[model samples]
Target: MEKNELKTTDSDNGHSPSETEKHLEHGVPVDAVNLPDPDEGLSEEERKRIDRALLWKLDLRLIPWLSLLYLMSFLDRTNIGNAKIDGLQEDLNMSNNQYNATLTIFFISYSVFEPLTQVLLKRFRPSVFLPVIMILWGICMTCMGLVHNFSGLMAARWFLGLTEAGLFPGVNYYLSCWYRRSEFGVRAAIFFSAAALAGSFGGLLAAAIVNMDGVGGKPGWAWIFILEGLATVVVATLSFWMARSCSTEKMDLQLTICQVHDFPDEAKFLSEDDRRRVIRRLKLDQQSSAEHEEFKLDYLWASLKDWKTYTGMMIYMGVDGALYAFSLFLPTIVQQMGYKSIHAQLLSVPPYAVAAVVTIFIGFVADRTRMRGYCNMVMSLFGIVGFAMLLGSGSPHVQYAGTFLGAMGIYPCIPNTISWTANNVEGVYKRGISLGFVIGWGNLNGIVSSNIYRAEDKPRYKPGHAVVLAYEAIFLLGGSVLQHVLLRRENAKRRNGERNNWVEGKTEAEIEKLGDKRPDFLYTL
Candidate 1:
């Protein structure tokens, strides 16, 4: 049993709550910092060694599988871009604008199902849930290969969107449960980097598949869909076996004590003396468990009611609108530069790759500095500059450079913003719902993104580029203002002797009984 948990409970006599409330009402300060460090008994070297081992466990257990799942999802959704250039349009005998309409259709389904999917992820274990979605989407993608016309294409895309709706937000909420807040950005980038890799891989794969044009009387574009879809199905099967949720849920799971030790060091900062005081305040024994097996189911509703929920949604929607637009259309944009299909696909690689690298670096820096809001603001500024340059420039080389900067600036900070929100909010239901709504709402921009590029704007795509640039600028301004406001509020609270507001709901006494949660649950700014 962990000492912190005991301090959080009502005193054995149950009268401690009233006494504590009275003291707080009188403005008598509680000595919150006088507690002893839980890890004070251990040497610094031992602590570092423990931290490293725990980090290794997290990487092995969670990061790779989560990243791979995200990679495939991104790949499956956008591979249509590759198929288009390989002759999907010609074979379907579709008009110039129909392909764009198909893209929009997917978002319609995607937006409708996203919030529901995120909420349901918790009901079933990841092993059962994620694999089911993967297999379904994979089969749909494969089925796309067999479609003879536009209707078939539209149907496949819609189902694909439906199955994929929950994946991003669900995984995000899942990751929050596993890693502490400080670790979120890097892990998220690691997961999202798969999108970059997928961009490169999708191009190479499309380039190779295009060579088989007219094989078996089917266009190479058809073969690409068939083969890629089959790959999705197979990969999804693997995910079923690999993906896991909580430690207690996996029957095959085997984690060593070294792995368990990676929990946040904030726990180590509490001592028996502090624990005793906490017990007196809220009142409980010193021995209790640090990591509990479950959390409240009602957290979901509580999370939805928070203003932070909508704020986070707006943040991601505005920033990610630009990110998704670029991701989905970059290959098409490159092809418009008059390069050969292969050249265009290959050219699309650098920008996404560069974005991935910056995202990873941003994660590490955010964790070390504990400054997510500032990092996000900086990333947005870069996006504005990059997009502005592209809108005005005509040179292929110069335009490509601008696109690269736009990609880099916007993507790196996005995961941090998401992780920031998840870390601040407690309770599994709230966390789950909050993550879902944030991601689901943000994804609605796909509706906007899909329509950004039109036949009327083709070749130069001046209108599409301009629209995204404006979107980026709006997001930048909004996020900057919101963060500033949040910071000022946080500062005011601290100055007014309201440190207890950092965690919200729980008074200092409740926190003592609940255990020093080590969430560092400060405001998002």
Candidate 2:
């Protein structure tokens, strides 16, 4: 069989060569040089075959492992709530306020250290950086089993938060590096569904683990921490050999790796044509040949200055506040509604399971339609209705159904928001910094969530539910709408030849230095 020929063209999105040349001569920045139109070189049948095979291979290789890693990270982080019901607070003689303080302290460290860790991840190789943090946090989680007092548990949790902060943002930046803007939603959704799955399975796991309370002279809650932490260590060790780092080549190409900074352009796992097609598609989508750009403080500054970054942070904060509150308190709320401890744990599973499925479906549709903001807005309505039901009703079954609406609504919005910001942002360092800052700032809401559901509020927790509901409304109706409008206006400006002053007469290197402010870059709505 003959290999396909690769073709490149100077025209981009209907811009003529003379027009581009005229713009360049007039000190106006032009988009990518020589964008490859890969589809023109192949028969439609061949293109379809390659697309299906390549995407399938990429999805199989990337999504499952990343999802599993995140699932474990979430499980370890939030399992304390499950353990609290299993007697962690009582055993440590912690008051309700002190217990809330412990949760708040973790987010304090997590929010503070997130950007720093992300910067370090960019400095180092992900294969090394990701697994190393996992191991460290796994150790910290294990140490939680040994803490006999509130102070000891607090110290352990603080360290765990520091270590775990990098994974979520790091994964978002990682996915953006490999996939095009349109392809990112589903991948991010699949990866984020792990958190929902963790909520579901964590409850079931706790229910079972608590049964071993009297085993080995340790409490069941202690065993829960120890066993889950040990499992994380084992997975982290395996990930050292399993997880692949971002490609080092100027054009992004997917390849599996076992160590730091190893990205072979022609790997044995893929055909030569397959590799070329992947690189071509990514280059055209990004409108640049470079995937791994040099890190600069200016990129970080640019991201900080970008209004989208702050708006994105606000959206995440609203959703995260509700998510953490519900995840941590659902079991307690269920128990308060006249259920036994074990029964509450079991009941928590169904809502999360339903959420996991809904999140994936929403992600698939969002990617297909390329309408992240719209999807997020609709999903948030589910949560608002759920909260309204809880607030307006006195019936137990009705409130139980409310949990399903809440989970389905809130969990799917997380991945959509993440991919929305990731899609609109340009440049590797800028995206990384934006993601880190957004996630870090978003976590500040954890402090609010922890305090809102006070022990005094007990069963109905109207104040906590109301606060979360209001935040969700702001995110869905206000923040997302504003962001979409801003993005559309910016994209129109780019399309209409309204150039940024900094980009004029600059080389590709100089233009890239402006990060997302490059005149040719278009923001995704």
Best by TM-score: 2
Estimated TM-score for each candidate: 0.80, 0.88
10 residues in a row with least lDDT, candidate 1: 256-265
- lDDT accuracy of residue 129 in candidate 1: 79
Model 2 poorest ten-residue lDDT run: 1-10
lDDT digits (tens) for residues 1-525 of candidate 1: 111111222567553333323323223224332334344567989766755665574576667766777788888898888887777888899886788878888888887787677556666655567778888988988888899889999999999899998788877776665565566668887887787778878888888888888898878888888888787777766555443322433334342111111112212222344333322222121212212224454555566667777778777887778877888888888888788788898888888788888888888888777777778888887887887877787788878888888887778766877877775565555666777777777787887888888767767788888888877667644765686577558545543335543345665556543322322223545
Residue 47 CA displacement from its true place in model 2, Å: 3.0
lDDT of each: 0.68, 0.79
Per-residue C-alpha lDDT of model 2 across residues 1-525, encoded as one tens digit per residue: 001111112456664333223334233233333434446668989888878888886676667778888999999989988998888999999999999988998899999988887678766767779899999999999999989999999999999999999999988787776677778888898899999999999999999999998898899999999999999999888777554533334323333432222121333345566556665565556423224567778877889889999999988998988898899888888888899979989999999999999999998998888778888888989999998887777789999999999998799999899998888777767888888988888887888888888889877888988998898898655788888788778767665555545455666666545555655556666
Give the Å error, residue 296, model 1.
7.7
